[model samples]
Target: MNRLKNCGVAVALLLLSGLTLQAQDSTALNQSEKTIKKYKPFDANLQLRSLYIWRGFKVSDAPISDVDLHYKSKDGSFQAGFWGGASLNGNYKEFDYYVSYTKKGFTVSVWDINNFSDFPNANLFNYNNGSTSHFIDAGIAYKFDFKLPLTLSWNTIVAGRDTYVKANGKRANAYSNYVQVDQVLWQDEENSSLHVFVGGGFAFGREKNFYGDHPNIVNSGLTYNKDLVLFKYHLPVAATAMFSPEHKTGTLQLVANIF
Candidate 1:
């Protein structure tokens, strides 16, 4: 617990330092408000999300259950969550935790993918190889609330480290880029809406999976959203399919977010 606490403090300090650096750069360039001010998330809110998805449409056994903790504040966003699952005959397991921040329209995330379990379930394989290294990705997603209800999300990965697989051990350095376009299916302006997105990603440096091996990734998804005025809550449920050229067959995931 002490170690995790220290790491959290370090992350906070790093974020503060980065903000300071960006502010200095903006000052030096005499950047205008129009340039600096973009996609500001002004309201403060806390959201809790739960996800349950089964692989291959199997239901008699165990399924993946994830609980996410999210917070958006000060035009900045932070999220951290632990992922795992349970079977009717299985025990316990732990994998990765997500820590991320978004300032303006840009976002960065750190993933500590830990694989410290002794499960013999090959079908329930999680590629986290228990390495203590961290992965960091920085990208930007812009939404244009224009005539066609358009959103353009483009993210060029700045850097990544410590992605591990049990078979080949740990790949300490990795880089990738992702792009997704989101279209509004329906919306009521301020209260509620639904959206759909399709995007793909590619990794160029190193890989083991022969198919998605070239750093290629494709994703398509549909989402359903609704809001309750009395409860001040918003619900978004989505289904996503990610196809990597490296792996056989695609991985499907269902996610639900409650705010």
Candidate 2:
């Protein structure tokens, strides 16, 4: 009887230990699930445009496409994303990655832009000091929810191939920059109604691209956006009328969001 009682006590102890371990495992699993739920929001989009144009420069004559995928923290304080674009006709291609942090109405972002198609060498890892296909852009933006919604943004090339010779005969990183201000004309949150935006860009860079060398209003535009429902799916369409007074040109673009 003593031996049998000892065996029974040992078995009970083993069972209790097993239950404690199971409870620990359950708690760990619950914590993991909570972590995943905290950062589970994801979004993706694709934009199709008839032509690839920026700030009045025609990039491609064929169809242009932009695809983006992003994940955000549950509190919306952090985000990371991939954005890629390519021309359907030819060699124009771009791949970019960005990470951002937001607080209140302000945001700061770091982006890596790779113009792989424009690289002379086919090697993707080439980061030569003199010439490189990768550029880093740093940006900050602020939105005011005052009586009239207004947004101000600034972006500058902080690294990579953005270089130019100054008047002092020194080669230095261009640090090309652009600033813009936008006003939201209208928006309806309940109905997902139309959106109207008006904005302008001032180039602080000498690059011959979007923000040209001239110190003028390089980009000014009015955009209208609305959704079209087809088969119970919502499709967004945007129309933009952009003009560059410094370049003395205007462009009209239609964008369709397929997914």
Candidate 3:
């Protein structure tokens, strides 16, 4: 608890320091306002992908399609979005909703995850029941503006059916947690970049099964992304190579987004 308090204090201090710096620059404030004014409030994107993978789980062997719709506040401080994925061959399906708040480089968000592919009978509305389909995750993230921009995030499932067995043979919420670090190596456009990321899950809770039953590195990858204007429409393409050292498996995927 003390450590968590300290972390909260540190994030508050960083965000406050950033705000102080921004306040000292009138030109920067004006530019930010201009950028906010030109920002669109809503966006939609559909992605076609070679496969469906999350963390270390290859959820689907068939091709995948993903859709996202989002709304953001003008100042970019708050956002709400729906994200859904489906396998082209009807092997996998997922739907999730998230809302986030950001201050400077710090962010916090809550996600409602509905994974229907694993158990078709999982009830989305069954919160107190043992067979609920919904899982809730809370996350905190920070992005550093250093020379090599870096992002760090921690997410933990706090509620729902993700479970573990207690010593007494009772089912309990696992609170499975995952942490990741990402760094951008190159960028030629606002939406296009080359990045490297590494992530792992804590062994406790449902992570035992979620991350191969032990505390180990699960998802590490290199990704290259580019946004192009084709036929006067914005299209984004990404190529990724992901490796799971714990599972001794690797995958390569190509993704294209149509907006």
Clashing pairs in 2: none
Candidate 2 residue lDDT tens string, 1-259: 9999999999999999999999999999999999877655899999999877764565666788999999988798999999989988767888889999999999999998886776756455655535778878899999998755788888887887776667998767767676778776776653333333333334354534335656667777787777878899988887777777767777878889999
Tell me the deviation in Å of residue 246 in model 2.
2.4
lDDT of 1 by residue, 1-259 (tens): 9999999999999999999999998886775665676454333222322322221112222343444444445445665555433333444344555566765555566554332334444323334424322333455666565654777766543432334344466344445556678888777765456666666666555553212344444555555555444465545555544443333345555554443
Q: 118 in model 1: Cα distance from truth in Å?
A: 7.8
Superposed by TM-score, candidate 2 places the C-alpha of residue 28 at a distance from the truth, in angstroms, of 29
Candidate with top lDDT is 3
Query: TM-scores across all candidates?
Result: 0.47, 0.73, 0.79
By descending TM-score, how would the candidates be arranged? 3, 2, 1
In order, the Cα lDDT scores of the candidates are: 0.49, 0.76, 0.85
Off by over 4 Å in 2: 1-39, 120-122, 166-170, 189-210
Give the candidate order by descending lDDT: 3, 2, 1
Model 1: lDDT equals: 0.49
User: How many angstroms is residue 131 displaced in model 3 relative to the true structure, after the best TM-score fit?
Assistant: 1.3
Candidate 1 — which residues are off by over 4 angstroms? 1-62, 70-104, 113-134, 147-149, 154-172, 189-192, 205-211, 215-217, 228-236, 239-254
